[model samples]
Target: MPAVDPRLLRYAKATRVFLALSVLIGAGQAVAILAQAWLLATIITDAFLHGAGLDDLSGQLALLAIALAGRALLAWVAEVIAHHASAAVKSELRMRLLHQVVRLGPRWLTGERSGELTTLATRGIDALDDYFARYLPQLVLVCFVPLIVAGRMFAADWLSATIVLVTLPLIPLFMILVGLTTKQLMARQWASLQLLAHHFLDVLSGLGTLKSFGRSRVQVATVEKLAAKQRKATLASLRIAFLSSLVLELLATLSVALVAVSVGLRLVDGRLDLQTALLVLILAPEAYLPLRLLGAHYHASAEGLGAAEQVFTVLDREIPATGTALLKANRTIELEHVMVASPDRDSPALDGLCLTIPPGRVTGVVGPSGSGKSTLLAVLLGFTRPDAGQVVVDGIDLATADLDDWRSQIAWLGQDPMLFAGTVFENIRLGRPAAAEFAVRRAAGAARVDVPLEQVIGERGNGLSAGQRRRVALARALLLDAPLLLLDEPTEGVDPDTEGELLNTLPAAFAGRTVVLVTHRPALLGLCDQVVELAPAAVAV
Candidate 1:
């Protein structure tokens, strides 16, 4: 990532506002710092050199106290502003990133891993807290504070000011050199960390499979190795950051020393007054303080900067254009020469595939495995766009119809039912948020979900048997009462008895609704009003 990414400003409006406020606060802080330094110097010179009694210096002491309190207050305000800005930016970025990921659709996401994406949206983005909270505010102060202090020094002692001016460039120059080196290291560390997280999530998801195969113990070693590698990468990145801080601190210290020597020599030779020399010495370190802190905090934020680069890359990807037209009430759907190619396949998943799903009827789509049955349903659901084809619903081109509106008319049940961590009633209610309790119970009964509606289930329906979970999903679908119903292997994982019950209930449950059922089961096909068969390569309408 560049030292400053424009995407941060482009994507996060809150960050932009925070930055603007930070600049204002930085200006006030700069003024407070100057006042604090001047008063402290004045108090020291009057008490020590002029032999001013405590009574005589009371006013100066009070003014110095006020300046000190104001500077501390401004620091606190800057910290608070940075913290809120970080939180707001993180929230905004996560929301936008999630929305964009959904907009990209599953077709695009199929080539990506869920674990990696999860880490990116969660822990990866969280790393940016330091970037906004500490580094960014210091960056603003680095710009303003040094200039303010240096200007005051020039008025007090020109030779000391010149020395400070000539040496200040070295700090930033070395900082840039160190930053260039650590940038690559930090990127590697972040990549390793992501891989480690992905590996852990993958292992957790497949633990059942590994245990079934008696290889669970073997994976433990692999996980440990990956973890060790991640730790090493983290340490290496930190080492580089520490080295960079050391270099900045050394440069700043040497620069201050040179300024101190110049001020001391001038005061001894009567070229500068005691008060002016004391002020110059005091403000010299203040001029370099912000720059030094900026360098140190920059390293602290390097990981976040790297993650931000990947986030920007994702955000920059182009999504297929969506339409604004609405689906007609009739809901008759047609596919004309639809071709959807999978990323890894040479041939299209659905090539020259034409089909019609008339309103108020049931249509069964049957095909061999990988015959684009699911792909056809995906096109209808607006989850995947055809590369070469048109989809029309009631004479309105689906390509020109609002996808959300079209989807709103659909109640979809995939091969695998998805269940959240909630009561059975709550899960079913997800189909229609405002549905009445009587309606939910009726739908559950129709789907053969005989359990009490209040029974709670674990994530992914852990407490429910495979057949029960499928019925729960079916109950949810039945509750929706959408104009269109799309079921992909709805009876999968259920026993023959349960399948028979579902087949018996499905016709009445889906009465008067347009349905596109994707199934290979002959029993399911027997219930459809019409059956469409697809071949591996293509199917003619």
Candidate 2:
């Protein structure tokens, strides 16, 4: 929002090079502006004062044409460069922000609004087109153009140059004041817009539930209310933007008028020649053009700047620490006084609890709802960090072990197994991308995925039955053959026959592997080498 934000350069180094190129182009453009003004003035004075014919001024007119064409070409080039730089910066920022979010994991994101984040990554970032394509290029021009034009004016007419210099500061002075107000308004408008987007997405995702409960009309009213608030905030922000542009236009116009009056008066008294007076009049407007355009485009880009500020806030958050040590072959895991606090709850999810899972055996973790069952799994998977203790693997602190390395050794199946949009074979191969076709078919058979291996599944397994989707996820986990297997409610949605078949395969599938099984199903407990029961919070206390 200032002439330039430092974060822009910090996030996009290519922008610095782009700005440098813009400076060079702006300097060339300034020279073209000065030359075009001088040539036009020279030709006009020849025709009007000296009664020269068209032929007498032909050479100067030709030079004037070249200057005009050159200026237009330079302007076009500047725009193209700005667009390229903008695209590169937006891509880099989006990718980096996504990586940061993934590193932070679900525990940190539990309290965040998904729709708001999606809007920020998509529409919010797209708004920055104006900032890079229009405002940034003009910002460079403002620094170079005015000084170049004013310097030429001094050599031609010192008094006119003095007047120009005295009035130039007024444009930026008024711009800063209006820009401060506009920045606040733009930020508010963007925040309201994000809320509206979030509400709209939420309604769409839950439209089925709303209709079933006969609350669809009620939700429509809620959406309308949010839409109205967004509309009001947007209009208010636009009013300020228009008002600021009007003020800047008036100030620049008045400054040029003052310069014209002084030049005309000097010409009338025979103190200045027609050529010098015309040059001053022509160059005066050019001197103030960059600053005026900069102010106008600044308002247009305010929303993007505000969105960028929010992106920086997300990127600045702390992520769970990862280490470089490789997980060894012995897969015994120990939790030492582990404590994990829930985001919305008053007490810790897992409070000062300790457990040991021996190597090469299946362990069952049974607990009531909200008794830290899922939280314990999250900690084991390195998705959440313990507040007061550590997790050790083969006597090595997992906190100091490489997360990717440790996770590569694990195959996880959650209560609601996530199945993506892909062919059955493709989804299963996601666990190990280089898996053989034979291996995929074998894993699918083991999980009782009856569909053809090439059958396509819609987004979030929409086209498949709930039981089929769970089997696909199971096949994915089985295909990986990871040293550590973790299953949470593995047979939750399947039929009894399919569940029995899966239970039968578990023993062979988990043979000689360390496994942590979390389930309420008694059938699953029969296959565990050791069953650990987690008591309620009050009982644990």
- Highest lDDT, which number? 2
Q: How do the predictions measure up, each by TM-score?
A: 0.96, 0.93
lDDT of 1 by residue, 432-512 (tens): 999999999989988889678899998888778887898899899989998888888887777888778878888898788
Q: What is the RMSD of candidate 1?
A: 2.4
The total of clashing pairs for model 1 equals 0
User: Which lDDT value does model 1 have at 194?
Assistant: 81
Q: List the residue pairs that clash in candidate 2.
A: none
At residue 195, candidate 2 shows an lDDT of 89
lDDT of 2 by residue, 96-170 (tens): 789878888877777788888998998888888999999989989998799889999999998888988998998
Worst 10 residues of 2 by lDDT: 532-541
